[model samples]
Target: MQTGKIGVTTENIFPVIKKFLYSDHEIFLRELVSNAVDASQKLKTLAITGDFRGEQGDLAVRIKIDEKEGTLTISDNGIGMDAEEIDKYINQIAFSGVSDFMEKYQDKAEAIIGHFGLGFYSAFMVAKKVDIITKSYKEGAKAVKWSCDGSPEFTLEETEKESRGSDIVLHIDDDCKEFLQKSKIEELLNKYCKFMAVPVILGKKQEWKDGKMQDTDEDNVINSVAPLWSKSPSEIKDEDYKSFYRTLFPMNDEPLFWIHLNVDYPFNLTGILYFPRVKNNIELQRNKIQLYCNQVFVTDQVEGIVPEFLTLLHGVIDSPDIPLNVSRSYLQSDANVKKISSYITKKVADRLNGIFKDNRKDYEEKWEDLKLFVNYGMLSENDFYDRAKDFSLFTDVDGRHFTFEEYKTLIKDNQTDKDGQLVYLYATDKEEQFSYIEAAKAKGYSVLLTDGQLDVPAVSMLEQKFEKSRFVRVDSDTIDRIIAKDNAPELDLNETQRDILSEAFQSQVPKLDKSEFMVDVQAMGVDAQPVIITQNEYMRRMKEMSRYQQGMAFYGQMPDTYTLVLNSDHALVKKILSEGEASTKETLKPILSEIKGLQARQTILQQEQGKKKPEEITQEEKDDLSNTEQNLSKQREEKKQVIAGYAKDNGTIHQLIDLALLQNGMLKGASLNEFIKRSVNLIK
Candidate 1:
């Protein structure tokens, strides 16, 4: 037997180890179990390499608990160290100064284990003392017993051990007696080693016997040893992938599709990425992708490890290249992490492109669910956009899907305006915009369904991407004006007639909160409605964009401005114009005569003033000119009031405005109720 001090420069090494080894003391179980698995795997590798001539029998790592003895043991049939090997690896902790180390690294406890070779010392987190009993597989090697009691000194002595393996016994401290429970140790094993490369046996399989659950003779292996992701893609079936997905995320719905990632050259990355049914809640499915190293689970918060957009996907991403012992902030800055992120983005894009090329119908069938993800990718990753250009599709209101190029070719002849800009018509709500959609369809033009939450920003992006292209909501203008390809129809009303009708229609329009409406006259065929309401493209887009973006909130807060287009060619509008003309003639004749006289006097006064300097004009002449202008304005307003008074009593004018309002989904609340009341009264 031999007892000696640990080879450390500072006597404060033990306190530092206890204080600065791990963040969550619960993580100690993972580190210790991981070490045991590594040792067991090393033994198997040695046997395969012919370094060990002995039998590599039953290499199951077992964890045992003894509550009464207040002890927890992790044993493994792997490379066991003799006394000299223990002194070299265990006694001498490199570059450790107890006092300074504690002060510098005390706050960064989780970073200490993988930084230095202190995997064995993590046992001290929950245990007051730790003992290791082992016999090496080497020929003629004697058994060794090593013991440490939370100090820089340890005892290494020759002892008897029949098995060629190592058993780590931790005497659970009073503060950490929870680990001495069998169920607690089993839970930790399931969490950290459920999919480890080697089998992990906890205890005998239990059965309900004699009114209690008792252990059977068979060993209860806790892990599957080989998870589904580690297998070749060719060997996996659809059901296999589905079953594995359920195992990974039991509460989530089945995924829409999956991508198997296996790459070797640049950096080793292997795992399965699942496209879950995001169902308009992209945020809910985020952080579902777990990161693993060598089949040991690392973390699911893989924001920096994966592309920002790819985090919306759900699954596992196992990469040994990702640094494990660093904080998330550090991992995000690592160059290797960025490479992994770019690679994952490339893989996801490739998979989507492949699906599109092989099965377009299937792809389109899944497009509604895929829209949010694709829009997110296009918004975030430029390279992803460059790759997705060919496969990305724009779906129209007729339920037809077209690529960007295909749609451009399809509509280049019909929807291009006289200004040489391609006009792309779109509708946000198919039901609400049904009339506008039909009007656009009547003109032999296509209307896209841009109703997704991201479509507001995406439409702006597409307009920039497509050359000489612009997006017009179907209700943005009259169908003729939406795609102004040929000659515009003429409105034959004289200036007097146009003003009278414009004011007549404008006076009766409904008043709505956050709403502004303008009156414009258009000459449409008699088949069209007498009145129609449409919004302006630029203003509507600005308002829509304001919902997702800041700095443009002023646009959102502004009133919705709609154009009340009165169809002059329609029979009802022609009748109203004739009535307005007759009713306003008597009121306007006197006003027009006075306005002409006032304009003539003002022109004469200006001529008189032009002949003299500022002081030359008499005060009486200036007063006469000002009085003439005021009387002329009063006569004009009276003429306008006369026309408005006629319109106020005209049921046809009010009904036409209400019909247009109802068609555009603008009639609501009190106005809608009043329209219904007037509609019922008119029928009676």
Candidate 2:
């Protein structure tokens, strides 16, 4: 036996390895297993290059747990290290054997994973002591044993061994005894080694024997030596891709489509990205894309590696060019990662475009599931938007689908306003906004169904992308105003009539929470509804954007402002105006006459004051002018009270206002019940 201190600059390297080597101690299993696989791969390369004439038998890496002994052993049938190699590789903490092997066999070695030699030290994270028994494949080579107890001091000795390989035995620490559990080891192997280059055996296959579960003699391999992404796309069938997807995510529904990424030049990359069925909540769909480096699993949280929008996709992305630290736990940003992101964005757009151009009907069938992803990419990535706009679809309320350009052409003739700005009318809810959608259709204008999770931001982006264009929700205003092609007709009403109508409707508007209504009388045709509720487009968009944007919280807190438009051409509005004048004209005449006299006196006093300088105006003249204004205000208040009284007793006014509220889906609780009762009475 030979004892020596590990050649390290720092004396406390073991403690750092045990405590701070990895973010998660569970990563120790991945590091050890990956090293074993690398050893196996090195041996294969040596044999292929005629360096080793020995027969290469089964190179499966095996993991075993001995709960009774409190030890976990990872054994491999690969090239093992003699005493000199162990002392050179193991004693020197940062010198990697794989790095030296790659330097010699760089052209022939397959998937050499170890870059930093620190992977072996990760074993100290969970093990109080570790032992390695290895024998070189060289003829007449002696087997060796190396032992370290979580310290720089280690023992190396010649030991008897049966075959050429390495057995890493870890005596788990007291606080880390969970690593001794069979289930825990199996879980780690499945997560980090499920797609490894070499076979990984966890335990024996289990079967029901004599009505009880028992381990069979067959080895239970946990990893696939050849995954779908590692293969050529032309050789794979559709079902094979789907089967791989099921292997990746068993509980998820079948993917809508997949993009096979196999780029070699500039930087090495290979993987399959599947377009998963995204639901209404975009957050739930994130972090599904698993990232790997040369078949070794890295992480699923690939936020920085992929673009923010591409995280919605699911499946695997394996790239040796992706930089990782020693632990291989997280990603490190570099030019390659950025290139990979741009490449993926382009691939996704190209896949979508191909699908749309080849089989548009099938693409349309999947649009409902694909909209959230496409819209997210369009809104977040400018380059992606430039590629995606040609294939991205706009589905209408009538269930017809059109590409962005196609929809623009379909509506360009009629939806353009008098100012030559193209208006894209959209409805959030097909049923809730059915009346507005129908009204838009009646005007021969197409209304898109922009109701996806990211549609609000996507529509905002489209407004900037399309020149001289704007997107307006169909229910945001009256159809004629939303896509006005001609000037609005003038209302034939005097100032008194306009004031009475405005006051009556405004008073009857319900006091809804977080809602404010402004009354406006418009000369819509007689076929229009008596009253329609319309939200302000800019304010409504700001509020919707606040749900996704961080700095727009102020807009979300403000009350929703809506316009309660009374159509003067409608018969109900006309009857209300005529009847109101007839019923209140007699009583309002004397009040109006008094108001007119006060206003005339107020105007004459204002004109007299305007003619004089501040020094020339007498205090009495100022007093008289102030008094006339007060009297005029009082007379107007009395007139408003009389009009409000008439409106309060008028069921038509209440019915019209309630109908507008119900149409907006805002009538709820007792108000909805009252609206229902009032509607029935009005019908009777």
Cα-based lDDT for every prediction? 0.82, 0.90
Query: What is the Å distance of residue 268 in model 1 from its true position?
Result: 1.3
User: Where does candidate 2 have its weakest 10-residue lDDT segment?
Assistant: 481-490
Residue 504 lDDT, candidate 1, scale 0-100: 93
Q: How does candidate 2 fare on TM-score?
A: 0.96
Candidate 1 lDDT (Cα, 0 to 1):
0.82
Compare the candidates by TM-score and give the number of the best one: 2
Candidate 2: misplaced stretches above 4 Å? 601-625, 679-684
Cα shift from native, residue 186, model 1 (Å): 4.8
lDDT of 1 at 419: 95
User: RMSD (Cα, Å) of candidate 2?
Assistant: 1.8
Residue 91 shift from truth in candidate 2, angstroms:
1.3
Residue 611, candidate 1: Cα error in Å is 13
